[model samples]
Target: MKRNVLLGIAAAALLVSAPSRATQLITEEEAKLPPPKGAVEVQQRGILRGPKVEFVSPGDAASSPLRLVLKFQSYGGAKVDPNSVKVIFLRTPNVDLTPRVKPFVQADGINMQDAELPPGEYTVRVDIKDSDGRPGTAVFTLKVAPK
Candidate 1:
């Protein structure tokens, strides 16, 4: 039917816009940056409820070109501000990853297929804010095993 055709076109468009074959999320140079001198402080206030972010797949360790999925849940009836999403490589002088994954970010979360990270362990920090201005952050380490 016409609906089916339209749906197919929509899917194709999405695929075209999605990030493909991500050889590396963080470049070797960026990864070599010195560790932060001190602990990074993050504080959230005012808002009675905040958003939550979680990795839905590819646990702590996975091979290259794996599916990277993140789930976001907003609280207090607030909706996620997709544009406020920030992805950072947690190294000294944090490297900004937001631009690299911006296209895949959505109000719900991020679903990146073929995320080909180099073989190593990486600490990443994801910061996001809800429509009400409440901020949320998640820090996790991903170990990409060698092929």
Candidate 2:
């Protein structure tokens, strides 16, 4: 009787400790998916001009100033609002950056001047967005030297 009780207890323990193999519930019919939305489109234009080095010193070493010139093409699409477009610059290493809004006078081009950068390698990222909220981005590397 003792052996039978021990065997029964072992069997009960095995049943209690057995791993559960549950299946994930799913409907027989396929799930309904939403239709795809229209994609956002953005374009960048123009050429950037600067020295091989990132820094420029026009006067005495102690008083020389640093300048960064950035240029790009304007959006050609009629749907894009030139006044609403904005350019953002992100500095690398130090991670200091700023944002500049393009003026409406020049709807087809961008020429920006930045003088607040310190000596280091900076990652310049340009973003253009249309009136409809579509956005495009371009990234470039700039190296600034000591004045």
Candidate 3:
């Protein structure tokens, strides 16, 4: 009878310990996310050449006339109709900025000069549609420095 009682107590202890083993904490590095695909380039531009967008803003937050530049490149020889493409600018969460959207037309490549944006973090989504209107979109993050 004592052996059976000891076995019962051991079983209860094992059950109690099992719950702690199942409650392991997960680290941020263990939940790392994947990077975005495709080739994307964003820069400040003074001239228009191709399907490129330039984001410009005041070097200081206290200044006016903020702008953004966007440059588009086709991957794997996939030609995107500039006229059928659209650009949407969304203010990043927890940031001071305004949201904007604009349509881009193909003219010797996609080029938008003097595109204005505020000084803050932003998420820019570019959508390119095919002749049939099938769409492909790319999202990029842009940081505008204070004037």
Candidate 4:
């Protein structure tokens, strides 16, 4: 009887599904927006030492449902402030993606297991501040082809 009960509990645990952390980073309509006018800035400067943002995964071009991994590295002993992270889609009006990705932001980096985006070219900008209030930024463009 004891062995049967243990096996049943294990089976039940296996059957229970865990909640998903998948986030829709960009909607279909948002992906279709026109490009930003003029030149968009792509640089980072800090007083002490700014955080370094790197697009660690999914390559420069990928299909939909991208596994986006952004790594943040701080220098001069300053830690990356999770709350100070901001994500932006550099479109005509500059769409704010910070709110959508805040839940996944951390001191070390932002990891989205499944970031859904439509098939289109995307220019993303990431801004962050260190514990000392030093600002940092990163800008990159990616192409999402149909899959």
- Highest TM-score, which number? 4
Residue-wise C-alpha lDDT for candidate 2, range 1-147, written one tens digit per residue = 999999999999999999643221111121122212332222335542211111122222221123334333333433434554444333212221323223211334343333433444434444554544555455554444565
lDDT digits (tens) for residues 44-131 of candidate 1: 4464477988877788689887777899999978999999999988777788988878878899999887776777877778899999
**Candidate closer to the true structure by TM-score (higher is better), 2 or 4:** 4
For all predicted structures, in order, the TM-scores are: 0.75, 0.37, 0.38, 0.79
Task: Single out the weakest 10-residue window by summed lDDT for candidate 1.
Answer: 39-48
- Candidate 2 lowest-lDDT run of ten: 23-32
Clashing residue pairs in candidate 1, if any?
Answer: none
Ordered from best to worst lDDT, the candidate numbers read 4, 1, 3, 2
lDDT of each: 0.81, 0.38, 0.42, 0.85
lDDT preference between candidates 3 and 4, better one: 4
What is the Cα-based TM-score of model 4? 0.79
Model 4 C-alpha lDDT per residue in residues 1-147, reported as the tens digit of each score: 999999999988876765555678999888878888764546545453678898887886788788888999999889999999999999877899999999889999998878888888788999999999988888877678788
TM-score of 1: 0.75
| Model 1 root mean square deviation, Cα atoms | 7.5
